[model samples]
Target: MLAFSKLTKSQASYLFSFGIVFIIYLISYIISPFTSNDTPFYTLIGRSILQDHVLPYKYIFDHKPFFSFVLYGVWDALMPIKTGMFTLLALCCAAGAATVASSIWKTNRFLVFFILITTGAAFKMLSGNTGVLQIFFQILVLYLLQYPSFLRIILSGVITAFAVNINYLTAECLSLPIIFLLYHNKKIIFNIFFFIFGVFSGLFILFSPYLYSDPLALIEYFQQQKQFLAAYSPSFTTRLFTVIKLFCYVLFFIPVLYVWVQQNIFQKQERIDPNSILLGLWFVSGLIASCISGYPFEYYYILWFFPITIMIAQIIKKPEKNFKWFFMPIAILTLFSVVDSTINNIIKYRNIHAIDYVKMASLTKGGSVLNIRALQTHFYMADLKNFDPYLFKEHIDIAFGSRAAAHYMHDLEQKPLSVLLPYQGCEIGAVEATVCHYLHENYQKIYEVKIVKLSGKIDHFSFELYKRKSGA
Candidate 1:
């Protein structure tokens, strides 16, 4: 074993940081196999691709491209369906942790620890979401930006394309190419070609045979996205909180802003270097994208944090003792926030008893298992087999979310389907009618009753199994 005593401060710090991150990754991997919402959906899609050979456009609810292909591909290849999702989620978490560690390493090593503790990076890793992969690509692009070689430029473009496939919002980081063009004015043509190649490659993967029967499905997908954007509402309070959270997420941005301000006032020539301009533009672009996206989720905004963190590091090359103090409170707050969020998530996971619900639905006979107002459809699918612990029934038709139900109902010829509606947000009459109409065109007066809990709590207004009267 290598001795720590003989190593220099920098070497020792690097090793220690790697060890800590690896340990966190290992722990996350161990716990990730437990059931979660999206896990089964991913598995289903992957299985569909492999077993049924069906393109996913008609079945997958969301219009986003087949971005999860690689993730699911690896999952199917490695473990059994359910186990694969957990393993893949764990790997994604590891990749994300590694990304954050590298991005922050150049600037301030302490901040990485702070991010892990504050962000509940470990918990997020176990959550089995794509946020980690998103962060990984962001850092990869930033690292590539530093190098000026043709191969690096091409690689960066390819990575950016892959990033977009993983999550369309990640395409926002393509702005990095513009920054590169500005920095390398002499090699503009090369940058253009590199970008075009990457875009085409990404488009090909996005529109693979597994995505749609016809390539036009890609166009339909974009049209849907347009509608979604047009209908989005801006939340000012959410925007303000996001801004504050990002600033606090990294302690150095405040100082970086101050530096930029000082440079502007003094009209300093050296301060306006290519690097500063690139970093400034990136930060601004990311901020605008995050703000405009509306109803900002934490992971969605975290992608931009990588570049901002790196920029902040570039700003504070040599710091005073006083500067270190600035990070203490920020670090403490971040740690607290991460811990709090992790604990709350854990509680929610325990309370939901998601596996039990899935199993129960699987065992119920004759009709499809409908989870109204459910968040993650995949988790429900994963639990179907487990619910019949005695191995009674083999499989059940599982559907969740308004969109998923809508899609399924559109294809079904049967009427009077029984559904188990969860106690979600306030039930809207119009929404329910719209859902009901898709299943049955004609109205019929059927038995109706309000479902109430044993504790005298009003559960839901149930239209007791409505079906259209024949020839009515």
Candidate 2:
């Protein structure tokens, strides 16, 4: 321990980075047992790869690129889907945080604190979003920007390509400003060649088995992305809030801008780091992409926050002692906001607790289940398509809220086995209502099953098993 403490700054930094990463891993593992809709979806996809070698497109409904499938590789190696995904998420978050910490350490300590606070809040708020992997790749790009060695350039290009795979939005967020800067600096020839090589390599990996079979499929995949963007819209209130939210997001960069302006006004040729430029571009590009994307979710905006935090830290080298007073309130508010939002979401979507219902449903062996207000059960069944072949083979049927069932079932291949349960009084036009309507239509065919009490007072729980009559 004495010898370790006496190590050089570089050695100490490396150890600190490793320690922080380990802590993140521990936190993620602790939270893994409690599941969510998004997590199970990733798990199900990972499990599918282990069971079936094919990449799903039409069946899964998510247009995520091949980088996400890298998680599948990790899952395959790790064995359990939840453990693999959480582990990967934890590692990515750590790597991203470390990149920021290391980049800013030489520049400013106060900026580092702000970066830590904002990043911590962002991580906690968007815990299960899987956007962290893309953010990590973005940070890597920033880290590589100043190096400019052949190796670093190649690696940065590869990281940028990988970012596209996780979410095309990442590419959209990081690409324009990077290209613009490259062009303005008259590095177009190099940029074009590098970009082409990266794109080709990325496509080769993305479409390995099917590249020769049908290249049009990859083109169609991108075309669908455009359609998705076109179709998205924000609610009226959300639209108004989006503008205010963007202003708040911009505050993360104020320090950096202040420093840049001050230096320019004084004619001081402050040696501009290439990494700082890359981070500025990343933040600017991401902000523009989020704005144009129209139906902006808070998680989508988070990809920009990390890079901006790093930039701000770089700008404010040694803040005044009194500066802490102002920073403390902002940090506290950010923490409280994230915590409050997370708790409210958990309460609203307690579907994470519905894992018990999933286990119960799995035990029933593909039988029709009368789910009360549990629409997540159907999504879980969809996700478990990789796990339970019997259910996949038999088509696990569900009858829930009218809107949910109608929405989910419209795309389902088979008609529901039976819809006998009635919508409870608290629910409006719910599964119970749908079941009541079904019962009214086919009175002689269906029978009711046991009703159970659930956690919430307003939502009474029940399960009814239904079998189709042979003649009908």
Candidate 3:
């Protein structure tokens, strides 16, 4: 029952911007051109939790921390609307980024609104990646660290611990906040000691479920997660290409780096702002984290959006004639890139009904359903149960190495009533020779629907469903 009249201009502006971003995201999800690979995987885990009351680590083989799934689970349990959940997560991210930018720039906070919503990271969040939600928590810590009180510093530590539970790699950001404490506070030792104390306290609270339920299982879970990550390390060459793609292809990096250079190298007379130093450190931390797994995933770069946008706002706040020429073209190119991506996404939307998930669901009823060489989305959309520990192809390949095909062959022996293949019939993973041969010989092709993607070109791909032959 609050009136807008009582609120300050800044507060009202934030509310209006938040509403606009949320509505835009909601509409974006409704007409989203493509679905990300990770969405279906996480949604399935959320479904399992709500319907079966079992954790992912216990029910299925998953390496991610439990917070995100729990968030999804709780939401689905209450409302069970996919688009609604996506809009909410996207809104959280926009709000967090806007708040962080506001803390840095007293005026022209709306400029960040445009920078954030137009970026590739924003689109990825709209496509339903839980990693976006983790960034929400990460930004909370970032904002809290800017002006440090003992309570605020301690709270930031607790939130940092919570963020790590969302995704352990965010642990790299731990140093940035601690460095803030050292820079800003006179009683560094006392503040840092309490910050560490708060972190441990957060961990204890978050992990209490595992501790009370089965401490050994929690230990084993981390061990398995560590091993899986270690085993899946990309080669040095691959990691180098990932870095190249991030810096060279993403145009937004230009302004962020330019501002840093302008401040540090060009304008040496003016004393550097402490806030700028922390933002720089955060940018470095995000870059290091993004490149850690050597994944060219668009969502990983989301970590950079907040700090980068804040840096972009600085150019608006204090214009320097020195690099005005360099900055102008870079800014225009970045905007064009973003606008092109958005139009392409909308243009790619196809009216063709790709997969008849309903018929597939009916055909696969009363028996197990397996999806091969298809996205896990096939399982979720059709409401089919995936009774395999290896939910993803990459995970299986990484976890089993040479034994991947053997594992697939073993799963085939279960004789799932219907096998869904998004690729052509008799086609599986590279090592899936035995799987292809077995499916061809024993399973009957009952239904298929062309998968017309947002690319606007039909590659002649279809989701083909197969049933085992009678007494095969």
lDDT of each: 0.50, 0.50, 0.67
Give per-residue CA lDDT, model 2, range 352-419, as digits (tens).
34335444444444544333233333434423232222122112332122254454334222444433
159-227: candidate 1 lDDT, tens digit per residue: 777777776667665475456652565576776677567667766665676354766766665665565
TM-score of 2: 0.69
Ten residues in sequence with the least summed lDDT for candidate 3: 344-353
Off by over 4 Å in 2: 1-29, 32-36, 69-88, 100-119, 122-126, 149-155, 180-188, 212-229, 233-240, 249-267, 315-317, 341-355, 363-383, 386-427, 431-436, 439-472
Best-to-worst ranking by lDDT: 3, 2, 1
User: All candidates' TM-scores?
Assistant: 0.65, 0.69, 0.82
Candidate 1 TM-score, true structure as reference: 0.65
lDDT by residue for model 3 (1-472), tens: 3787898999899779756654544454556423465655676787786678665576556677876677666666665455435545665576666776686545355776656665543336465565567667877777776677788878887888888877776887546645774567677787778778778888888777778878987787788788888887888888998899777644645755776658654676767766667677777777777777487777777776556766767776776666566465545554454444445444433321355668878988888766665556667667787767666646777888888778777878988787767556454343367888888898988987765555654333356788999998
**Residue 249 local lDDT, model 1:** 49
Better-scoring candidate (lDDT), 2 or 3: 3
